[model samples]
Target: MSDFLSKFNGENYQEWVDEKDQKKEPKNPPQKETATTEKEVVETPKKEQAEPKNEAAKATKKDVAKKTADASQTTKSKQEQKPAVPDTAPKKNASVHPTNRAQVKQEQKTATPVTATKRASTEETEIDPTYQKKKKRKRILIGAGTALLCIILYVIYYNSVHVAMPDFTDKPVTDVTKWATKNKIELDLKQEFSTETDENVVISQEVAKNKKVKKGKTVSFTVSKGADPEEILKLPDFSKMDKGSVEKWIDENKANGMKVVLEFNDEIAKNKVIKFEIKDPNIVAAEYKRKDYATVYVSKGKEVFEKDISVPDFNGKTKAEVETWAKTNDIKMTYEEADSNEVEVDKIISQSIAANEKVAKHDEMSVTVSLGKAIVVPNFANFTPDEAASVPNLTVRVRKQFHGSVPFGGLIAQTIEPGARLTGKDETEVIVTYSEGAPFLKDYKGQVVGDLPRLFYEDYHSKGADINYTLAYVDSYETKGTVVSMSNFNEYVGMSYLVTISISKGNLDQPAGYSPKGKESLGDLEEE
Candidate 1:
């Protein structure tokens, strides 16, 4: 009886009941219990040590009785639902009463898990295979959904850290750098010579604009260093180069000490470089640098220096002609002006050297040029006609007119003003007015006949006196061309007063066949 109680308390009460029902092969399958009895059986050890053996036995019997009743009810219900298995028959000892050794023995025999496993397998076989396939498909779908959720989360994370690339071409490098710093982007900046882009500006980008770029990723771009400086930095041969080109090179290279010196070169053309000199003697012209103290000699043709030249005679030549000659001969010549009646105006009066003299080139010489004759007029107010007529270098013309307050043959006025200068270009003839005494005929007795033409005739005509003169030739003892007598003597002349002058023809024998001797008037003599 103790062994029976031991087995009953040690084994699960519900399991024992299920075992007993299975061996009986009832006509129906039992319903499964909601709660398992394994946990309660495991706690039985602890409860058996706490309770007295008799009490434990009592509790165990009660639990067995309750489980027996539950099994009987489940059998009855299952029998009504389905038919039982036909292969196995019911055993007599397969009863819920645990006091029967044979019943416990039969229950133990049927309690093997293999039989339960086989039964469960038989029941599982009745299920449709497609139901398991559906479960497998559901598992696959669940795995795919989890994987998709992970992918979605990764994409969201990637988008949050990455951004689209901006347009950087032609933008300033500073702006690009600031953008990079703000976006946590790294930049691989490179510089290149560009004619199209300005200095410090981006020329091109390795990444396309608006393309995705992860933060902290390196982006490559080219920056402009501006137009190429190699053109200006190059050093070329300066010999025989144009002056303007050399000067430009010097200015671009900033060769402060380098200068251009123009020198005479007979072989080289003007405005072309002849040679160059650098302070460093070892450094030649081909290897010159901007910092070197260099000098470039340029050609300005040759200097002018004539070895020998002949001195020219400038007499009677114009100053212009002398200047032209001096220029051609490369002779230094100086000029001075003087008034000369003999030399013409603008003509060289004299030269420093005589004609055909030997002299060196570029010698200094002087020339005197003529400004013609300078004639200063004199005041004739206090002078007589005779004195005015005797003035030098001037042709004096005398005219007599009646004056109220002057003596006969006295000077009146001159045509040219006093202190007036007349050059050789002007007319040198001057007319002087002389006073004739009051329109009167002077006595011409015993006066030379030349006096009529020299004085009295002009005096009478100048005063508008109507005085007439008659010349009679008669035998007289007087010099030739002398007036012997006059009919009117010292009278105030009227409108047509006649003055007869008897002039002596030198006393000589008359020649020719037609010789007439008479007191003939000047008119009769003229007619004859």
Candidate 2:
């Protein structure tokens, strides 16, 4: 039973031990907790370190998000703002986008600081747009200012360096510009020796000083250093002075610089001075002081004379007697065969010097008595046209008349009579007549229109025949040297013929026959 009681006690003791163990275990647990707390405390520093790092990472993330948000906000604000349009809008749309333009502008604005920072960081930086633009503008202004200053400096230098010159006229050289321009004259300067003006100065002027000259007119002046030699005096003009006055003037002016020389001139009247001369001739300088004398020439008046003297009849006088009478009365006589067949030969035909005129003592007298014979007339009829016209001092007249038998326009007879005594210097007249033959038609060819009829008559007249002729023109022809068609009355009736003849003796190579058109041909003719 003791055993049984021990077992119960053991159980009860174990139960009691269990209950105490629980209680004791709670206390150990507290000690273990304390140990755990100590272990945790030991690990707390590492955890603290990790927590601070995590908190720092979170804070950095928050700050980065704020910065991104701020940047996005700034971008959105900028996007919302419209760029101001320039007043002068582009005609065409610009190629750059507004955003790109704003970005470029923003980049420019931020470029300086960025560059500075970049320079600080990297030690090298690119130039900024603003700085570049300001530098470019400054350079441009400086260049422009430099150029302007250069121009101003050039002007100042030019003005300061100029020098004033003297007036041209007051200088040594004479100024001919004014004189030449004013007078419209051409100036020609010539060098000469003169005392009147300084060296190279104008000594004398042509056309006188201050005289108005026409354009292209010549003006001459002498420029010289010294004077010239004296000139000889010139002879005086005495064209209308009397002979005595001229001689007296020459004698009285002997001391002056002139000498008289004498020569006879038939053109000048007798006892008259024809011309004079200076004793010594030379070119004189300006302002020469000398008494100038002149030789004089005078004229003697015309010779005296009388006309109309009484004729001394030489009818009964011999040749010697007539010669004596002619010598005493200053008469000239010539004899020829008388025109009257009944008159005797050796008689005077005519006298040239008239009777009873006052005559000079040196007068020549001539007397001619007739030779007792009839002289044959010279055949002047066959003379050529020129020879016929050159009959000197002989007057001739031609006329047309009518004859019943001779050709109509033939020479009839002479008035003074051919082969008759030609008395004195009187002209002989010729009378021509026309024949009474029936009219023959003439070929009026090459006759001047105005002179056809007269020329036609003359053609036949020169043939020593006369005829009635009617002219007809075959064609309009030109007039040449003479008329070239006439009728022949002797034969070939009703037949037309051509003839050429000169109409008048005056027109036959006579000196005054035809008017000349030029001086070359008119030299032989008389002047009007």
Candidate 3:
């Protein structure tokens, strides 16, 4: 384009261009030759060039003289026109070129508008590529930044809008449910008993508080119902059974889950001891375990009076009277005899226990008897044990006879006549009577479990011995229940004895057995 313009500036083209410049330059000053001149040049060419074409041949030679002179003269004359761009970053300053703007405008009356238009266009062409690229880059950066800002805002709004689990434990159930409804969440409620938490209050929660969750998510929780009821249970009528025995039964029956409580009851008989009592006496193996337990209520035997009491005077009471009093008051007594002229024989003369001294119920009382001044032969033909034993010079030997009842311990005969002088060395021998009190146990070992109790009384007690019985059953192959063992073997008729009876439950499978004598066969019963 520069080569084209340089070649086009021939003598004729130069003359024509100068002629036009000189004609139009008078209307505007060079200060107006700004970055805006290119636009005016484009619009004015058709209008201004018509006039120049008509006179083209006439002004041909004079253009050289005018163009050279005008250009040099005009440059120095407009020494301070408005700075073209006002600087790269333009600012409005009316004070700028205070003297130069008016002077240039006034002096440039001869410069044509065409020349300024040409120069402005040339300057812009050189700078436009770099400047336009920078403008486009600025636009691209702004567009991308706006889109990124929108994305970040969207992310923040989405996260903030999500639901989070609230602390249910802090609020009541109604408040929590209301909050959940408002936030569009589902609550999974469950109830349980707790000592630390009140009834209807939440005891624990499955989901943690303040965790962000999706809308309508379900949360699980446990609400407390306060404390539950306590349950009571009783042991299998552990009559006369020791604590260790109860413990063993509990372990074997899987009843260890229950708590054991020991209490004292006076009505129950003694075990391996002189004390036992069991009440609410239904005895069957427990079928199931309960979380709570009942009191077994084992008797420590009837409550004893541990406090002290004054001794009763027994100076003249008969043996029968003392015996009756001791049985009524639950007192124990032992009698020792010695000769004395002062107190009467066959009467409590002086108590071995002092009169009016403090005494317990079980403390022994020995009553010393007295013989009259001298021994006279007394009539002892049909005397009782008391009458015969009290004879002053007589030592009595006693024997127990089961039949020919003259009453228990009654004397059948004695050595002396009704009246005689008592001066000889002699001892008196007498026979005493006894009766049947209990049944023989060995005969009842193979009897049916249900029939043993009736047979024990009718067969054993109706004849002699006194027996206390206990019944225990187990699974066996013989029958559902059959008597298998007995505890006593003394075969005596007068003494009180304990008999532990074992029976079979007669199933194909036998329960596990624990016997110190190993397992018992029908005839291999061991005495415990």
Candidate 4:
């Protein structure tokens, strides 16, 4: 059947021609005219079959032969009128047999639908004049839609990647720094002295607020550094200011080399400014800057009567009068007694500070008071040797004696009577004696043996019996001439008894050429 269709199509179907057949064939006719011709050919036989049998028999064989040739001529013209299909349309399996009606019917029933390319070509062949306008409109709409979609996606992506610049004016720099850190941006910070803006606050920004910016972009902003030191600052008139105001000013401006100095001034009152000067002598105090060195001198008031004072004459004045004068003048006075034949007793003889000599208040002064020509001896009874020896204008001599009534070491007697008065030109000597109680031999260990005899004699002698002691030397671990031991110490010995004592040689081993200085009685020892 396919072979029969191929043969039929090769002879009758001009629209399904291959490239080689198309090259040989003439241009085809309109598809509508060809379709009209095919319809007439198909219906002519139908018309003959539908006619009455007598009418069919009346037609002659010649008429039938002429009708068959006309039919052939009509079929060839229809083939010549077939419209050409585009080269892009499918051509395979497109042929059908015309004479085999049953085959044609079966093929038409099983044939694939017409391809869009072929349909389009057929439509184009009969297209109206407005078709190109409609097609151009559709193409323009598609291209515009594609471009709009791309722009929408780009906007979404751009918004996600970029950020808007924030307003930084009048805000703390810390805020700007924090925002920059969060956005992974770099900051180009500049400092400017602003009178209106506070320190560490942003004054201005290079980028305006709400403007788009990419991440990691470097932005420049200016931060305030408080007021301008050189422009806004002015030095105050320190000469007319008090110490407190000047000091406070110095403290506030000390970083700029301002200071205050205190000095003693006789004219200006205490704590008042005497003068002010800039450290650079060429720059006057009135034109000083915050960074200029300035000094304000404050007065410490007059020093009159603060230090120097005239010494008062104390000659021939009573001690009471001199002390009163010293107390009133705040002078330190030390008194001493001197025997004077000219001045009266208890009167000031002389003063260490000469008459009208200059001296400071509270300065020490030595004053000498006169004791009259008659020097009365003080009572030595119950007085120790040291107490007796401390008397002024008198020399004291000490001696020990045994007494039955006086306590041990108490004063016993003095050579001159206690009330005796003597006219002495110089220091008068007085001898006072102390009691040793009852005389007894004493332990002399660790005592110097050289004074033993004198001690015993003084202790025992009282215009009566005199005690004596004998001495012996020995090699011992004690200092030379020091007593190591003594005999008859615990006995009830009285005066005039002979007591034995041992003296150390200061070495355990005796030396060569050493002589035995044998035991000697007190009388012999004293004589030697």
Candidate 5:
């Protein structure tokens, strides 16, 4: 009996132990319960199994809790051990569960990539301010260089092949352009017509020589064309044809486009055509076209006929016979009386258009018939200045000059002698006496007494009149003082005597003085 009790107790104890072990196994509750129930259902075993399983589940939960607590402690300890961070820094060491921590770690790694990317981007954005400015300056330099190049090219092109044009005068437009081109100068042409000059000539221009101009620049010029040739056709020729023949010729020439005009000329022969002309008298003989009719002028041909006849020796011919002969020979005769008494009345002395010379048949001739001479008048003497001026066509002038010995207002010597024949045509000269002012008469008294007569005579000779005077005498003599003189004086000294002189007189109006011989003597004196 004792042994049986012992075995039963041992088995109960083993079962309890086994149940506890089973519960401790790392398995789910259902699986554990199913496994435990399948083994035995003893009352004591069942109760133990249920209790142990419940305890085992609780232990497992406790173990999980402990592990979480240990991890949190480790995180906290690490956070405490790490250096303190500023409030602005993110908390990287904050405690978290395994799965949550894994997510946070992954986020930090992703953020790191983003930060690195941003840093790289900032580094790439950094650029030098001066570098940007340099780039702009380079662009400006390029533009300026391009502009400079263009300007230089323009200057070079302007210098090469530049030309100045030539001056042209009176050159035609049609020909001037050609001339300019031939001379390697650019040409600009202007045209004009002138009545004063021939046609087709240049009149003006620009771009004178030695002046610079761009290549291909034109020089302007003016040109002229002469007056219209048609205007030359209107003129006419009316030479040497008689009135009737001229009319006939005009009619005939009109059919051939020639014009004719007629004008009377007294010097030309009557009823005859003109033979000489100014506008190319030989134009008709030149055989030019009728259109150039202005090239001709007409004039009457000069009369060349000549005739000669006897002069009738009119030296002794009577006036009636000479007049009859002159009429028959178409001669004009005229007569004038001679001052000489030699020639007889009604006799001819001279002829004009000298006899025996060939002359036109109707030409007029003149002759002078002679008549008996007549006595000529004698010359007048002692004419005064007023009397000398009375002659027809005679001029007189009076002048006074200083004479040492002559009295003021006194008559001087005559320029010509008295008692000469006076004539119609003669020129005379006169001289007049003069004296210093009456207050200066003392100068005349200084002269020697003997020279006083000569001095007075010389003063009288200077008077511009036909008169003679003799020195009277000195009335009172005072040294360095004038002497009183009379108009008519006699030989006397100290006391003056008045003397009267006779002068031949006849026609006192005649020129100052005349020669006694005649008109011939007066002429000889004038010659001398």
Candidate 6:
């Protein structure tokens, strides 16, 4: 009964239930000893009082191990020696009921877990086979999943670091944008103008081709707006435009990158333009990347022409009158002379230009004037009658006359005198000599009067005159027969005049008596 009560100690309730339910199998038990039963039962309380709970747990395991060993030894020894039985059974106390023995046996069967109740609470439960297989499958699946995740991560990292950048040199901007976005890359887009590329085309990129880049890396790029969207210059027709207007346009547009050059043309007027020279002929709506040279060809005008002017007429006007008018009007005028019977002298004959003719400054003007008809008489002195009679375009006549030192029939003087201008109808005459003596009667002065005209009728005879000549002989202190006095000396006079003279007849022996001779009248000698 004591052992039975001891088995019902406080901690064995769960173990007792487990044993009744047969939830677990029992291990081999220890062999019993009559000698140790009372001592062991008493010593268990003392052992518990001395040791800690963990130490008691250790002691319990050791006790279990010793019981197992002792049971094994007892079994082995019983097999070897056929153990002897006790002489007789020891008697029990009379207080123990017979029914109690049966109950005790029953209790002993229920009490199989009393020893198990002392086992540690931390002990592992035995595994189920089916549950173990299921658990193994779950572990394998988890390990595989982890390994696959690692591989995926590695692949992503590799792509980010080792992937090559795409060529964007001529790619469209929108395509580049999409590529960048899908790759999760950062993009910096910039715009610029280009003449060699299409609009919105990529001109340049920051990242080089075939180079590795990380995901989300930044990229810078430039795009083209297709050949500079500059305004094409609509130039004026410079051929008709003046220089001043073209210069003004240049001044205004030079700030917009217009560069102007100048040239000259002869066909255009001065300060006017001929044409403009530009590199692009058909270009419109174009923009300039820099200043370009464009030429504006201007005109220098005709080199031969000076200025325009109006010419004046000079017909029927005198040269003097035209000269004065030309000086006033700043005209360049010159004069020429021409003879014409119909035109009056000093009158304008013709002019280079008609009236109201247009002309320019420094232009030449020529005028012609008329000179009247004129005639000059020919000289007839010192010529023979036949030579003087042969004067061109003149009738010639001669009068018999005496002239000094002139031979007979030689011309002495002329009527309608030499160098005297006349009309074509004027008559002409010449005084021709037919006698070889002095033209006038001889002077009888300071002569001895001895020499007399033996041939006075042949030479040096007195001509016709009005003067009465008295050939008187007188006595004087002069040579004999010398002329003493005369009404006129031997001088030239008109044939119509008369003359008187006196002769001295002094004797040569002494200056005494002079003789007188009878004087005769000399009539007009020309008639003679």
lDDT agreement with native, every candidate: 0.67, 0.42, 0.53, 0.65, 0.44, 0.56
Q: Pick the candidate with the highest lDDT.
A: 1
TM-score of each candidate structure, all chains considered together: 0.25, 0.22, 0.24, 0.27, 0.21, 0.21
TM-score of 1: 0.25
Off by over 4 Å in 2: 1-233, 252-346, 349-528
- Ordered from best to worst lDDT, the candidate numbers read 1, 4, 6, 3, 5, 2
Q: For model 5, where is the 10-residue window of minimal lDDT?
A: 32-41
Q: What is the Cα-based lDDT of residue 396 in candidate 5?
A: 39
For residue 156, model 3's alpha carbon misses the true position, in angstroms, by: 1.4
Instruction: Please state the error at residue 212 of candidate 4 in Å.
Output: 3.2
Q: Which residue segments of model 4 deviate by more than 4 Å? A: 1-130, 208-211, 228-232, 235-528
Model 6 agreement with the true structure over 219-305: per-residue lDDT tens digits: 899998664334354566667678788888766443234444544444667887776665565534244223444677777665455
Ranked by TM-score, the better of candidates 1 and 4 is 4
Best by TM-score: 4
- lDDT, residue 141, candidate 1: 100
Give the clash total for candidate 4: 1
RMSD of 6: 29.2
lDDT by residue for model 5 over 310-427, one digit each (tens)? 5545666677886777678765555554433455655666767555566554566666665455323213233544564454432334455444355654444444444323333333
Cα error, candidate 5, residue 393 (Å): 18
lDDT of 3 by residue, 1-528 (tens): 443343224333433454455556555544544433223321122222422222222333334335534553454244235424222211356453665665544343324333544443422211122433454587799999999999999888877677777787835677777887898878898887555566678776777888887776787878875554332234455555666787676554444344455545555553212232232235323432333343454446555666376767888877777777767766777776655566665677777777678766665667765443445555454555456666655555433333334454544444545453332222333233333223334546666777876876665555444656788876555556666665664464434567787787776654368332333455653333
| Candidate 6, poorest ten consecutive residues by summed lDDT | 37-46
Q: lDDT tens string, model 2, 398-480?
A: 44433445554334453444555454333444332223343344444334456765755665554434534443443211223
Which residue segments of model 3 deviate by more than 4 Å? 1-128, 163-186, 190-286, 289-528
For model 4, residues 10-128, the per-residue Cα lDDT tens digits are: 22222222222234344663243223323222111222221212222233333433444454455445345655322332346765355565654433322211121122221211213
